[model samples]
Target chain A: MNSLTTAFFIAAAMILFAGCYMLVRSHNMIRLVIAVEVVMKAVTLVLVFAGYSNGNTALSQSFIITIIVAEVVVAVVATGIAIAVYRNNGDLDLRKLNKLNG
Target chain B: MSASLATLVYAFIGLPLIAIVLLNLPNRKFAEKLCIGTGLFVCIVQMATAVIAVLLLIEFNKASMSFSQFWDMHVADDAAYFSVDFLSAVCLFCIGMVGAVSFAAAGSTVRDKILNYTNMMMVLLLGMNGIALVTDLFSVYVFLEISGIASFLLIALYRDPVGLEGAFKYLVMSAIASAFILLGSGLLFLEFGSLRFVVLEEMLQAGVYNNPPLVWLALFFLVAGFAIKSGNMPFHGWLPDAQTGAPSPVSIMLSGIVEQMSGTYATMRLIDIFLLNKFTVVNIGMMLLALLSIVLGAIAAVGQTDFKRTLAYSSISQIGYIVLGISCGTVLGYVGAVLHFFNHSTFKSTLFANAAAVKNQLHSTHYDDLGGLQKQMPIAAATSVIAGLSTAGLPPFAGFWSKLLIIIAVWQTQGAFVASVALLASIFTLAYFLRIQHKVFFGPEKQRPAVKEPKDGIAIASIALSVVTIGFGILFPVLLLALQTQGVL
Candidate 1:
C-alpha cells in the first residue's frame, strides 16, 4: 500500500533475480545450489509480499506450501545431481565441464 | 470422416498431454515397437487430417470461405482465436509430412524407451501445432513450456555424460527464459487483468500504453527468453552442446524442428503484437541480429571439425534467413519466412538423419574419421546432395524461393547493401555445405575395415525426408499461395 512496502517487494524480487543470475554465472556447483536456495526463499518472499499487499491470507498460505514443495523436491533433486557431477568429474566448477562442448 | 478426423486431431494432441501407464511389456525392444506403432499411428492420423484439411482448404480458398471460432475462456475484452485458416492448415501439411517422415525413419533408434519416446514426440507435435494454431499469449506460454520441458527430458534420456550436460544446460537456460516470460506476462496481466492475446492487442492499440519503460522491459525479457531457445549468437551457447551431445534421433528433431519452431514463432508473434507502434525499431533491430547471425554462423561453421557441430552453426545461419524475412515486415517477407521455415525442417531433418547414418557407418562424427561414402552408401550420398543443394538455396529448390523473396524484401525495404550481404551469406552457406559434402561423400574412398551401408531405418528415413524437400521445392507456388490466403505469409 505504501512506498515502503512497495520498496520491500521490489527489493525482494531483485534479490531473487540476483541470486538466480549468480547461480547461473557461478562455476562452482555448491555455490550454484546455494544460489538456487536463495531463489526459493526469494519466491516465497514474493508470494508473501503480494498476499500481504492484498490482505489475502489464503494466497500466502498456498504460496508457503508451494515454496516448501519446491525446496523439498526440485532443490533436493538438483543438489543430488550436482553432487554426483562433482564426484564423477572431481570438480565443482562448471567451466571445467566441457565434455559436452562441440 | 471429418468429425473423426477432427477428433483424431484432438486426440493426436491430447493423448500426449495425458500420461499413459507404463507397461512391463516384455523387454525394452517390445516397448520400442509399441512406441513406434503408436507414434506412427498418430502420424498417420495427422497425415489423414492434413490431407482432408487440404481438400477442405481448397474449397474454402476458392470461395474465400473460412470456418473460424473464438474462445474467450478469460474475462478479457477480446477472445483467443483458433481457425482452420489456410495458413494454419498448410502448416499442418508441413507438420504432417515431417512428423510422418521422422517417425518412419526413427523405427528402432528409440527402441530403448518406446513409450517415453512416443509420449515426447506426441507432446512435441501437440506443442508445435498448438503454437502454430493458438492465438493467445497464455496458451503460448503453456504450450511453449510443454515443448521445452519435453525437449530437455528427451535430450537427457540419452543418459551419456555428455548428454546429461547438454540437457542440464538446456533445462537451466530454458527455465530462466520462461521465468522472464512469466515476469513479462505477470506485469501485462496486472495492467490489463487478462492474458488473451487478442484483448491485449486491443488494449495496447487503444493508446493506453505507448512504448512505456515497463512494456519495453517486458518486451526485452520476452525477446531474451525466446532468444535462448532461438539459439542465436550470444544465447547460442547451448545449441552445439545440446545438439552434438544428444542421441542421433533427438539430434534430428532438435536441429530440424525445435529451435526453428520456437524462435521463429516467438518472433513472428511478437511482431504481430508490436506492429502498432514500434514497427521501425523492431525491424531494424531484428535485421541487425539477422546480419550478425549470417556472418557469425558462417565463421563458426567454417571452424568446426565435428560434423553435427557444423550443422548446428549452419542452422544458426539459416535462422538468420528466417529472421531477416519476417523482420522485413512485408507480405513477401513473411511468405519467405514461413516457407523457409517449412523448407528447413524438411531438408535439415534429412541432413541430420544422414549424419546419424554416417556416424553409424564410421563409428565417429569427426570429419577426419570419415570419407568417401558414395560407393558404400549411394542412397545417402544422393540424398545428401538434395539436402545440401536445398540448403544452399540452389535453383528449383524450395529454399531458393524462400531466400530469393527474403533478399528481394530486404532490398526493397532498405538498400542494395543488405541484399548483397544476404546474397553473400547464401554463398557462404553453399560453400561450407559443399566443402563437407565433397570431402566426406564424394572424395576418394579411404579403405577402412567394417565399412557398411547405413542401417535400413535411417536410410529409409533420410530418403523419406529428402522426398519431402524435393516435393515442397516443386510445389512452392501452391504452398506460398496457401500461406498468402491465410494472411500468415
Candidate 2:
C-alpha cells in the first residue's frame, strides 16, 4: 500500500510480462532459457516485496533460497538438453526441434 | 486414528525414498528381476498404505460429526507440513495403484538401466505422494518441482534427439508454471502472511484480505500455473510430445499418474483452498477449457497416424472429462470426477502398456507398420480392445460408469446442452479408437512372418487392468457403497 511497495509490485508484474512475451517470441533455446530465468527473477522480486509487505521476511527469504536451488537444477538440466538438441539437430531453434510431429 | 493416519502418510512418503536408496546400492550388482522385485514390493506397500489410509479415514469420518474441523486441526497442530484426509487418501490410492501398475507394465522396457530407471521412478512416486499429503502451499510447490524434475529426466531417459526435445519442452513449460506458482504464492503470502493451505482457506473464508483484486490476481496465477502443469487446452503443447517421446512405461506413468497428480490433483487442491467459496471464475474457466480440450483433442486424435500420438491426444480428451466433472462444483460432480480419475488412469495405462508391447515387437507403432496383430499378440490385442471400449465409455466398462456419472452431474449443474455435447464427444472417442482397432488389430495381415506376443509382464499388467476396468464397472454399486461409507459420496 506504500508508494514504494506499489512501485515494486508494478515493476515485478511488468518484468514478468516482458519475460513471458520474450519466451513466446524467441525460438532460440538459450534465449528461451534466459527469458524463463528473467521471469523467475521477477518472481523472486515479488517474493521479496511480499515478505516486506507482510512482515514475514525470513519465510520469504527461505522460500527464495529453495527456489534458487531448484531453479539452478532446472537450468542446468535444460541447458544440457538444449546443447544435446542443438548437437543432434544442428540448431537451437524450437521450430527445427520437431522430429516427433503430431 | 489421526495420529496413525499421519504416520501412514509419512510412511507412504518415505516408501519411495527407501526404494531410491535400495535401488542405488553402489556395490551390489542388480539383476533385472531384483530391481523389478524391489519396485513391485514398494508399489505393493504403497497400495497397502493407501488402503490403510482410506480405511482409517472412513472410520474417523464415521466417528466424528465434525470431520473437516478435526481434519483441519489434526495436522496443523503438528510442526510438520503434511496431512491426509479422505480426498488425499483417495488420491494416494490412485497414485499407488497407477504407479504400481505402470511399473508392472514397464516390464522389459527398462532392462537396460533398470537400477537408474527404478530409482528415478521411486523418486517420482515420492514426489507425487509428497504432493498429495503436504498441507502447505510452499511444500506443494517444492514437491511439484521434485516431480517435475523427475519427469523431465524420465522423459529424456534415452537421451536421444526426440527424447531431449521432449524433455526440453517439458522443462520450459514446467519452469514457466513454477514461476507462476511462485509468484502466486508470493502474492498470497503477502495477503495472509502465511503459506499454509489451512490458514489460507480460513483467511479466504473469513474475507481477511484487503485487496480483492490482488486476491483475484493470485488465484488467476495459481489456476493458470496448475492448468499449464495439468496440460489443459491452449497449454498442452508439451503433452503429446512428452508422452510420445518417452518410453512406453514412462508414458503410462506420465499419461496416467503424473499428469493427474501434478496437474489435475494440484488444481483441485488449490480450488478447495481458494476458489470453493467463490466458484464463478474458476468454475467457468475450467468448464470452458475442459470443453475445448475435449473437442480439440478428439478431433486432433482423429487425424493422428501414429499410435502413441493418438493415445496422447486421447489422454488430453479424457482428462477433459475429469476436469469437466470437477467444474460442476457439486458433490455428485466431485464423485464423478474422482471416479473418472481412477478409471482414466486404469484404462489409459492399459492402452499405453499395449502400445509398448506393440513397439517392442514392431519397433514402431505407426498405422502403416502395424496390421492384423490380433493373432500374434492376442492378449495385448484383446486387452487393447477392452481398454479402447472402456475409454470410449462403452457399456460394462469402468469408463462407461464414470462417464455416465459425470454426464449426469453435468446435466444437473451445467445443464443438458453441455452434457449432451460431452456425450457427443464420446462418439468421437469411440470413432478414433475403433479406427485404431481396425487399423492395428483387424487389418489384413500385411506381414505373414511370425508375430510375437507381448512379454509376460506387460501381458499380465494389461490383462489385470482390463479385468479391473470391467470389474469396476460391473461392481459400481459396491464401489459407490464403499465411497458412501468413506463420506466421499
Candidate 3:
C-alpha cells in the first residue's frame, strides 16, 4: 500500500480502538458522546481513505468528508439530549435505567 | 437514467434530512407547521419519486444492469455499484408511503418540538432510502447510523424514562453492530483497499485475503453485524422494548419497515454480493436463523400482554419470512424476500397505527387494560383487521400471496418437511394475531378507554394507511405487475 493509504488506515484503526475503549471505559454521558464522535471520525477517516485508494473518485472522497462535517450538528443534537438525560438522572451509568429491559 | 439520477436520488435522500436544518430555524410555531407540511410534501414527493424509481428499475432490469458505475479504484479500473431494481423500489415506496400517512396523522401530537419531530422523520426516511440505494459499504454504514440514531431519538421523543432506556439499549446494540462492520471494513481495507461491495466481491474471489479463516471470520463478523441490526433470533431482544417505547410514528417506521431496510439490505448485500461465491452454505445458516426467528417470535408474542409488544414480536416473525426467502436463494427467493419486506412495511405500520390508536385512546399499551375499543374507535378495529388479516396471510390479502410464494419456493428445493414446517409457522402467526385482536378489540365492552383519544396525526394516518392496506390487498394482480416491472414478482 502507498504511504498515504497506510497512514490513513493506521490512524483510523487507532481512532476506532480508542473510541471503543472510551465507550466501554467512560460512564459519563458526555464522554460517551465524545467517544461516539471518535467512532464516527474513525469511520469517516477510513471511508475517505478507502475512497481515495479504491474508488479514487473525487466526488466520493469529497462527499465522504463533507458528510463527516455535515453530521456534527445532528450528532450534537442527540448529545444535547443525552446531556439532558444526565441532568435528570444525576448519572450516566446507563445500566441504572432499566425500565425498558422488560 | 442520466448520471444526474444521482442528483435526484440524492435529493430524495436529502430533502427530509435538510428539513432537520430547517427545523432549528427561528420561530417555533412556524417550525411545527413547516415540519408537518414538509413531511406531507416530502411524502407526496417521495411517493411520486417511488413511482419514478419503479420505472427506473424496470429500465435497468430490462437492460439487465443492477450495477451502476460511479468511479474507479487504484488498480481496479471500474468499481461496481448498485442500481435500483424491484427490491429497492418496494422499500422506497413503503418508506415514503408510511412516512406520509403517519406524519399526516401525527400532526400536533408531536407538540413542543415540531421541527425536531418533522426533521427526524424526514431524515429517517432519507437514511432508509440511502441504505436501499447505495451499494457502497461505507455509505451504507454511515446511513445506517443516521437512520438508527434518528430512530433512537424518535423513541426518546416523549422524554419518558422508559424512552431514555429504550434509546440507550438500542444505542448499545447498534453501536456494537457498527463496530463489527468497521472491523470487517478495516480488514477488507487492508486486503482490497476498497469498500464498494461489487468491487470487493471480485477482489475477494481472486483470493485477496489469501487466508480462508480470515475470509470466514470477516463474513461471520459482517453477518453478525447485520443479524444484530435485523434483530434476528437471539439478537432480537431490543425490538420489543425499543419499538414499543418509541413514538407511534417511529414504531410504524421501525416495525413497519426500517429494520427490514437496514437489516435485510446489510445481510443480503453481504451474502449476495460479498459471498455470492459461498451463499449455498451461508444461505442455509440464514434459513436456520429464519426458522428460529419464526418459532421464537411467535412464542415470545404469546407471552406479551402489551399491545405494541405483541406487534413487535409479530415483526420478528414477519422478518422471518424475508430471511427464509433469501435462504432459498432462487430468483423466486430473492423476489419473495423483496416483496415480503415491502408487504410487511405496509401492514405492520398499519397494525402499529391500531396499537398506537389504542394506546392513545386508553393511555395504556397493555392489551388487558384496553378492551372493547371497537365500540370506541371502530376505524382502529376495522384497520387492525386490515393489518392483521394481511399479515397473517389470509386469502385475498397481500401477505397471503407472498407467504404462498415463500412456501412454494421453499418446497421446490427443500421438500415436504421444510414446507410443512413453513405451513405450521404461518398457523402460529395466525394464532397470536387472532388472540391479540380478540383481546384488544373484540373483548366485552368495558368502561371507556383508559385515555382520551388525542386529536393527532394517528387518526389521519390510520385512515390513509388502512386505505393503502385494503387497496393493495385487493388489487394483488396489478401490484404484482408493478413489482414485476421492477423484477420483484
* Chain A TM-scores of all predicted models: 0.82, 0.96, 0.75
Which structure among the candidates has the greatest DockQ? 2
Name the 10 consecutive residues with the lowest summed lDDT in model 1 chain A. Answer: A66-75
Expressed as tens digits, the lDDT of each residue in B130-158 for candidate 2 is: 88877788888999999999999988888
Q: For residue B37, what is the lDDT in candidate 3?
A: 76
Arrange candidates by lDDT, highest first: which order?
2, 3, 1
Q: List the candidate numbers ranked by TM-score, top first.
A: 2, 1, 3
Clashing residue pairs found in predicted model 2: none
Candidate 1 per-residue lDDT over residues B109-173, each given as its tens digit: 55566567666777778877776667666557666776776676677664667776787677566
Error of 3 at A31 (Å): 8.5
Please count the clashing residue pairs in each candidate, in the order shown: 0, 0, 5
Off by over 4 Å in 2: B1-6, B31-33, B62-80, B275-277, B482-488
Q: What TM-score does candidate 1 reach?
A: 0.86
Model 2 chain B poorest 10 in a row by lDDT: B62-71
Tell me the tens digit of each residue's lDDT in model 3 across B1-489.
455345445446667767677677758866666777778888788778777766765655553123343342122224435456556666777788878766765753455656677777876887888898776777787788789878888888877877776776677677777767765664565456566766787876666665466456567767778878898888897888888778776787788777888788777667566555354666677788888898889878877888888889989988988888877867777777777777888788888877777765666787668777776677788778877888888987778878888888888866778778877888788888888877888888776524444556776677766676667668977866865786544
In model 2, what is the error at residue B485, expressed in angstroms? Answer: 6.4
Q: What is the C-alpha RMSD of each candidate to the true structure, in Å?
A: 4.3, 2.9, 4.9
Error of 1 at B85 (Å): 4.3
